[model samples]
Every structure is written in structure tokens, then in C-alpha cells.
Target: MKAPYIFNIQKFSVHDGPGIRTTIFFKGCPIRCLWCHNPESQKYNQEVMLTSEGEEEIVGQHYTIEQIVKKVQSDQIFYDQSGGGVTFSGGEVMTQPIDYIVELASRIKRLGISLMIDTCGVAPVENYQKILPYADGFLYDLKFINSQDHFKYVGKDNSLVKDNLKFISDNGGAIYLRLILLKGINDSMDTMEKTVEWLKENNIKISEIDLLPYHDFGRDKYNRLGRKCTQNFEVPDEQHVLNIKYYLQQEGYNVKIGG
Candidate 1:
């Protein structure tokens, strides 16, 4: 199998999963969101990005399962203490070759460390099937409850997203549902209502609901990468974000302000 290009192996990452984990960021994504923070990671190949000092820095590198496993093992003590482990994130890590992910995840779990898969949910369900056994949990993003809005901003049909999520849930995979709150975009009481209704209609069991307020941290990165940045998005109000949390909480869902 071809080795995957990982842009970064983020260590001590507390938000990606339960414990302090080394979140392996794979390079390449199929869908482009209007508010993507890591715009430089949208490509599959090793590429260049202009640094703060105006230098060209390569963005990706090849890594084998052994290399990543070793890196995760270095933090084994921390994982043992904090219940954190390894998270496979990406330019949609699920879009990478299935065999490679399966092997990588299998090897990582052999160390008795937990494994989390952060996905945009735009991939073949076969890929999820291949890795489900090894993945301890999934950080599944619910960008929009409606398919129309999903394609309007994300530029991809959300059918596959819902299908893959349903597949995982039916298979009894633990899931942490992540909701991206954009002020004038998807943050609304009506949207949240549809979200709850859909989850019930589909019988999708989510372990937790995480309300993520949109931030412009990646706007400069887009400029650095020489790409057009969408400037119309706004962060949801702090009180509104809390309101969303409370709303979901009222629906009998365990909701948190952030991931």
C-alpha cells in the first residue's frame, strides 16, 4: 500500500478526543467547506505554504504505521494516565486508502491505546466498515441538518455523510457528534430542531453533542496559501452558543460548548 501523507502529528491535543492524544493529520480532502481553518491541508500531495517569514515550507510527509505507532507509544505514559490515545484526523483521513488506515489503526490499538477517527463523513461506507473494529470512537461533524444547506456551504452532497454515520451507529460505534455553529449560517433554533428530529428519525445514537463556534483562525492561512477566503462568516454569540447547548440538553442529548 502507498504511504499516506500526513501534514502534522499534533501532540498533547486535548480537544480531539478524551485524553491527551497525538492527532495525526493526513493531507488531502474531497470536500471544501467555506470556513475550513486548515486550508493548506486541502491537498493530497506534499506541497508548499508561505511561512510567516515568507519562506516556502513543505506541508506533508510520508509516514508508515511503525513510525506513527512509535510516536504514539512515546506518549503511552500520558495516555495511561489521562485516558488519551491516538486520533486519525485529516484532509478527511477516511478518504485515504482503506488498507492503510486499517493497518495503521490496528497497529495503534495493539498498544492498548484508544483510537479516534475525526471525519467529515464524506467517504465510502466500506472504509468505515474496514476500520470500525479498531476505532474506539468517532468525532463526526454535523455541519448542517439539512442536505440543501450542507451542499450550499460544503459543496458536497450530505447523503453519504448521513449514510456513513448511520452505518457506524448501527454497527454500535461510539460517536461524538460535532456541530459547527456559524452565526448567519447554520446556527439557528430551527436547525437544531431539525437536527434532533433527524437523529431520532434515523435512530442515530450519539454519545455526546459538541457545539463548535466558528472562528476565523484559518483566514490568514488561506491568504498564506494564496487562496480566496470567505469573509462573510461570523462567530455565534456566546449566549446563543450556550442557548444551543441548553436546547440540545433539553432534548435529552449530552451537549457541550466545544469539542
Candidate 2:
């Protein structure tokens, strides 16, 4: 199989999964979320971005499965110590070829390493099915419950995302639902209620709901990539995050403020 484009391999990433993890950031994403922080990761092919010094710099490179697995294996000692593993993050790791992901995941599993796919859940059901056998679990994003709101903010309809989530649930896939709580974007009480309703209606049992507070940390990346930073949403305050967490707990759902 051809190698997949990758933008980054972040080591010692604590927030990507259970323990200290190595995050493999794949390139390309179908949905153009307005609040996306990794603008350099949105494209599949190699691209150039401006550096802080105002010099052009390349952003992506292709990596073979063997090469990636070897790199991840170097961190085996850490994984064994902390229950950490490798997290395939994005530009939607699902956008890569399913066969490639399956192969890489197989290798990781063979090495006794846990594998987690951080996805936007906007891919086809078959993609999920093909990857399910290899992945230990998923760090799935749930941006919006209402389709229109999702379209308005994410530049795509929520149908595929919702359907894929339901599919995962039906298949008894382990899921950690991540909701980016952006003030005035997707943090409305109504949205939260709808999400709770949908989960109950579908009988989806997630490990936990991680409420990621929206921040402008990626704003500089947009500028560096020469992309327009159109995000105008404010980051939710600490109290707001706590309130949402409390509300979700009240609804009988396990919730955490951050990953």
C-alpha cells in the first residue's frame, strides 16, 4: 500500500488518550470546521506555510507503515510504564486509506500497544467497519447535534457524523465522545440536551464525554499557513465548563472537562 501523508508525530502527548501517547497526525480532512486549529493539516498533499520568521516551510510528508510503526515502537518503554499508546489523530485519520490504517493498527497491536483513532466521525460506515477490528477504541468528535447548526459551523451536514456514531454504538465500539465547547458556537444548553436525548434514544454507551474548551491556540497556525482565521467564537470560561460537566453528570452521563 502507498504511504499516507502525515503532518506530525507528537510524542509524549498526554491529552490524546489514557496515558502518555504518541499522536500521529494524518493529513487531509473532509469537513472544514471553522474552528479547526491545525490549518496545515487540512490538505492531503504536501504544502507550504510561512514560519514565524516569515520564511516558507513545508508542512507534510509521506510515511510508510513500517517506518511509522518503528517510530512508535521506540516509545514502547513509555507505553508499558504508563499504559500509554499511539493515537492516530488528524486531519481526520479516517481520510487515509482504510487498508493502510488497518495494516498500521495491526502492527501496533502485534507489538502489544493500544491504538486509538481520533476522528471527526464524518467518514463512510465501511471505513469504520474496516478499522474497527484494528483500533482499540476511538476518540470521536461530536461537534453539533442539530444538522443545520453543524453545517453552519463545520461546513458540512451532520448526517454522516450522526450515522457513523450510531453505527459505532451498535457495533459496541469503545468511544470517547469529544465535544468542543465553543461559546456561542456549540455550547448551548439546547445542543447539550439534544445530544443527551440522541444518546439515550440510540442507547449509545460511551466511556465518557470529554468537553474540550475552544481556544485560539491554533489561531497562529492559520496565520502561518496563510489561511484565513474566521473563527470568532470565544473560549468557554472555567465555570461554564464546570456547569456543562455538572449538567451532563446530572443526565447520568460520565463527563470530563478535558480529554
Q: How accurate is candidate 2 locally (lDDT)?
A: 0.89
Top candidate, metric lDDT: 1
Clashing pairs for predicted structure model 1, backbone only: 19-84
**How accurate locally, in lDDT, is each candidate?**
0.90, 0.89
TM-score (C-alpha) between model 2 and the true structure = 0.97
Q: Per-residue lDDT for 1-259 in model 1, tens only?
A: 9888999999999999897999999999999888898987789988888998999999999987888888889999998899899999989999987788899899888889999999999999989999999999999998988899999998987999999999999999999999999997789899889889999999999999888999888678887888888745888999999988888999999888877
TM-score for each model:
0.98, 0.97
Best candidate according to TM-score: 1
What is the lDDT for 93 in model 1?
94
Q: What local lDDT does model 1 show for residue 166? A: 95
